[model samples]
Target: MPALTDKQKRFVAEYLVDLNATQAAIRAGYSAKTAEQQASRLLRNVQVRAAVEQGQQKTAAKLEVTKERIVEELAKIGFSNMLDYMRAGHDGDPYLDFSELTRDQAAALSEVTVEDFKDGRGEDARDVRRVKFKLHDKKGALVDLAKMLGFMVEKHEVTGKDGGPIQTETRTWREVLRQEKKG
Candidate 1:
């Protein structure tokens, strides 16, 4: 196969930074007006695509990141249960209990707060301990996992007024120019 051009190499490097093709093309010195089209075309080129994949593989190796690892982390947050981090007290009130919290369970925690205060004044005073813990967004993590696994496909439908199909008009450039000259 043909080697990538210098500009294409630059594009592959820039694309790896954030994987935004249009921005990568622009940064690689492609014309801003045509960067989006250029990026699409470049990505379709066999040599460029190979280079980009090779670059990604190298980066993944360096960072020790893999698709399975990412999915596992997302699953940790998606499948985590609140009961894993708390338990029912003698009075039947739920209280935070991390005595048996596992590493996987801890991964799902977003925040934890502990407060100690007096519930009442003087002789009637009682010490109260409050523990609040927030879990990472379970729905968001599940949605991400579903998308990554090809189980969820997001669709956007564009329509005209009243939810009907969009209306479009097609005209040739020559006809448009002639109409403009007449007006």
Candidate 2:
């Protein structure tokens, strides 16, 4: 067998990562059916093993350089630290007030029983109410009411000036009532 070039050695190492001879062979540029035989032959050669190891080391070094460059570029773009990136990417509902809770209130909140709390007045205490409505598409066919109204209204769990997640359960509409009156 001839000595493999640097590019050929790198391809072989990538294929060997999963230890599937057929896959390794195909990835190293052999036809799918020939991959198994080619990979087996390559693996058995001492020179090929040495070359593959060298290729893998070079690939790893290149990957490290690429990762460092990406981090450096991100820092230049105002993401000075990894924590800032993580906070911007994943943190949700930044305005929730956890500071006002008493010990019992916090315990109750932990149990998820806040949904049952009601005012002493005669009116319904639920923050959200579900209402169904019909909508028509451009072709005058009835579209899903929930989807249509969903676009118009936003949902919230804890209510303040700032919005939260949409309350899918408790919703109402005056427009649907008006349409009913006209029909």
Measured against the true structure, the TM-scores of the candidates, in listed sequence, are 0.69, 0.29
Among all candidates shown, the one with the greatest TM-score: 1
Supply candidate 1's per-residue lDDT for 96: 80
- Per-residue C-alpha lDDT of model 2 across residues 29-89, encoded as one tens digit per residue: 7777657766777778788777766766787786775544533333233212223212232
* Runs of candidate 2 exceeding 4 Å displacement: 5-21, 65-183
Residue pairs that clash (backbone atoms under 3 angstroms), model 1: none
lDDT of 1 by residue, 49-86 (tens): 99999999999999999999999999999999988987
Q: In candidate 2, list every pair of residues with a backbone clash.
A: 128-170, 129-170, 129-171, 155-165, 155-166, 155-167
List clash counts for every candidate, in order.
0, 6
**TM-score of the candidate numbered 1?**
0.69
Model 2 RMSD to the real structure? 29.8
